[model samples]
Target: MNKKKWMRKGIALALSAVITAGIAVPPATAEANTGRIIGAIIGGAAAADEMNKQIKYYNTTEEGRQALFQELQEKYGVYYRWDLNSQLDRIFTNLTAAIGSMDATVYDRPYNYFINQQEGFNAFCTLGHNMSVNVGLYSYLSNEDEIAVVLAHEMGHGQKDHPAKGMKRSLGPTILANATGTVLGAIAANIWNGQGLTKPMEWEADNLAFEYISRSPYNPGATAAVWQRVIDLSGNNSANAFDIMSGAADHPSNSSRRDNYAKKLTEMSGGKVTVDDGDVYVNKKRLLTPAPAGGMSSAERAYFVMGNLAAAYRNGHAASAAYADGRTVMLGAQPIISCTDGDTSAAEIAALLNQIK
Candidate 1:
């Protein structure tokens, strides 16, 4: 048999083995298992082939691409405006040109941009090189410069082949055998999960976005301003111990991300950029900054810490047990802490840190 057929047979055999063992698996688990089995059997070439198939499936035609985008928007409760001559479209065109200047390969691909009525500050690029910007994002941002920063960031994902790479990692060789609905569902979920970009990939996109932003008329400081707003909106700050580790799953923490943009802006502008306390400054003047806020409650801290510990366990880290102990103490103290202002004492914080150590 050919390797592709062998891979399919191996996946079938693995499923049969599970059934013979009387082990019941959920559809999602079964789907994941199928991917793993195919990955183990077929390796890289097959995975790449599956990825290419998916890319072609999504990128074949404008109508097909729009249908896929419509399905995704429906799945995510996103309402999008489709007018080609709208102000949002104009901005997208300008940003696309900026991105194309940074990487000419973008011109060779079919890229589409959409404006969505999502009331959250977000944007993402799909595997087909289609992009979306949220109206809520526009409401939050102050100008076209900030909008360009977000657009460039999404374009960076396409420029770096992140979506295709993510599809390869996610679908493996299972794409050759899975039902269209199942594969599309997985793709939608992956898009929701930071567009299938890992934490490091998010930073890489940020860096690439800054590179493009530097060459354009927009100030690179807009990048830091956006992240600072994210931090403020998320109620995460330098003073929050739990929030410090919050972005380990999909993206870097707000502080780290803001610092990254600040550093890059400074470098690109030859030390003309200034970053301080979630504010970006240019030429001795404040360019953008969010209002300050108090720290989170002890209940919030406990919940966040529990989440962190749970993630650590899920990732199979050795320190999960230690963090679990810390979670226990925090949860046990929740009643007392929740009634008060939810402040964790310094000694209590130190004890939790020691336990995690």
Candidate 2:
């Protein structure tokens, strides 16, 4: 086997063994040694530090996880009880088994994961091993590899300490707004709006996710394809540009990502593996389509649009990117404002654009 594949399998074996024995490898020592491996993902050390602080506050223990769980339940109408708990345990069990063999610091505590039943595809990772993937994402992923791609992507954020840095930089003030929103519903909008994360942070998550997956047996090529599936599933709408529903946050445009992944796959496979549509693998052994493209109609468009609008309103631009063009203030495309030859009301167009998205 090639060196990368051999090492990847070795790590996978080690990780799987660790998980089988119910062990966790921590990154604290590594963090100290590396002095926080926050490069290019978030903007700077300060931002990475802030994000870590937030993650530490949220995921240090069961109580903290429960507290955040409760808060999420109240806000998103989700329950952290029963079958969901069972599902998490199963996922944890498998993930632990898969990660134990690696030569890395294994922590005692397993990472915390939760799913909000929100309509759009969104997930985020916090420091101290805190991560959440939306139920909307689950509805579409369909397979273990796809799910692995998603989990690894989120895990990349935590492993790289992006959340700790990002939270410190952005979420601190947003927390205050969240408090105000708790009392006055109207305040939530403003609170979520101002606390959006930086673009670079998103890119970091994507690249790290790609890195982590590259080290795994599961195809790293699928990352971009999975993202494309998400885009197609949610319609071609870019309204929720920042929202990770379809879970493509911390990255560039879907079409752009597809192109980039294809190029990278070529390099990784020594020009043997070719990609098409950003979602298929074309190798000598076989041709594989990651997932089927369900027909995207106007109704689906409206569904994802509404989902994006909600995500935009709730998580601000950074969180709503999956469903619509969250990056642009306008709901649809670039040049945000549409001042045609005859029509007027630029401000109205912008406001209406928000509603429509």
Candidate 3:
């Protein structure tokens, strides 16, 4: 087949897979839900234990350490710096001490930190407690507090075993479902199960980072400021369907994250949170303006109203009721870009909206 034909076939296959998986499975019984909850708890513990064992083994061997270092240098071009007197080193040491004071258990882990020469605002923590901060992160940060915020977020990924947990969550359900001899069940299991977990994980990591930073001398407002800066730099006009759908799939919108951190800062300060009197996006769509009576635009409101109705149907509401709700709210509003008036049936529209979810 030609390249274009092969690519078209590939797209078809992927969409087919998604639609097959998107078919709603029967809701689990209450007992099943409870059992699954217990299973998840036990599974989480086992996953954590396994993660720690792996980290310990990796760090204990000279060959393993050398392999890890080589991989970092080769893959990412990161350099290990040992200058204790350097400014970056001094800041790193102070931040490390602050983090250690907050959680001695994590501090005692076989953690390794490195700096990269990359000129981008980025940092990451590996499954084995290895962390790297780019030079651009330091250059961009306004203060030590901001730097601490970035470091703490990366540490949060390690301390919470997010990488391990993500691996488990991604693989466990599909494997189990496949073993039960139901291909459709396996697909649905992976799709529905993994779909909602990622954003929560990011939020959990942020919360963990905040907890650590709050106990240190660093200002907790740095978290909010960092997110605000991200929004300012992104130059994203999020008043569109694609942006909203994409935001829902992965991390929460930058605005939502900034607002969350700002709320935390307010709680820490024992005061009311003052929201910025600027444009605010929700789910990546610029929805609201200044505080007083600010609300979503007609198209944005219609899109979400349709989205919620679709969710209601998926949750076992009557199709008639779901359509009724959609029509009641969305009929008067301007159509969302991806959703236009057509010969499309209610069922087709519901399916499309559910895909957005």
lDDT of candidates 1 onward, in order: 0.51, 0.43, 0.46
Q: Give per-residue CA lDDT, model 3, range 1-357, as digits (tens).
A: 985455434333322332222213333453244334324333343433433343344344555444554555454566455551254565556666766787776655656666766665566554356666666665555456656777777677667776445534543554433222232233334322322237777787778777776666555556765655555555333332222112224667767866677666545433412334443222233322321111223322222332232223333432232221342222113221232243244444444433332
Maximum-TM-score candidate: 1
Which residue runs does candidate 2 get wrong by more than 4 Å? 1-56, 59-66, 73-109, 171-196, 215-217, 235-238, 245-251, 277-357
Regions of candidate 3 where Cα sits further than 4 Å from its true position:
1-66, 79-87, 172-197, 236-248, 272-275, 278-357
- Please, what are the lDDT tens digits per residue for candidate 1 over residues 34-153? 556655675555544544553555655565456566655554454545542265666667766777775787777657766655565566676567666656665555456656777777
Better of 2 and 3 by lDDT: 3
> Candidate 2: TM-score?
0.49
TM-score of 3: 0.49
What would the per-residue lDDT of candidate 2 be over residues 303-340, giving only the tens digit for each residue? 22222222233224422221222222343222222233
Better by lDDT, candidate 3 or 1 = 1
Model 1 clash pairs? 298-342
The TM-score of candidate 1 is: 0.56
| Model 2, total clashes | 57
By lDDT, the better pick of 1 and 2 is 1
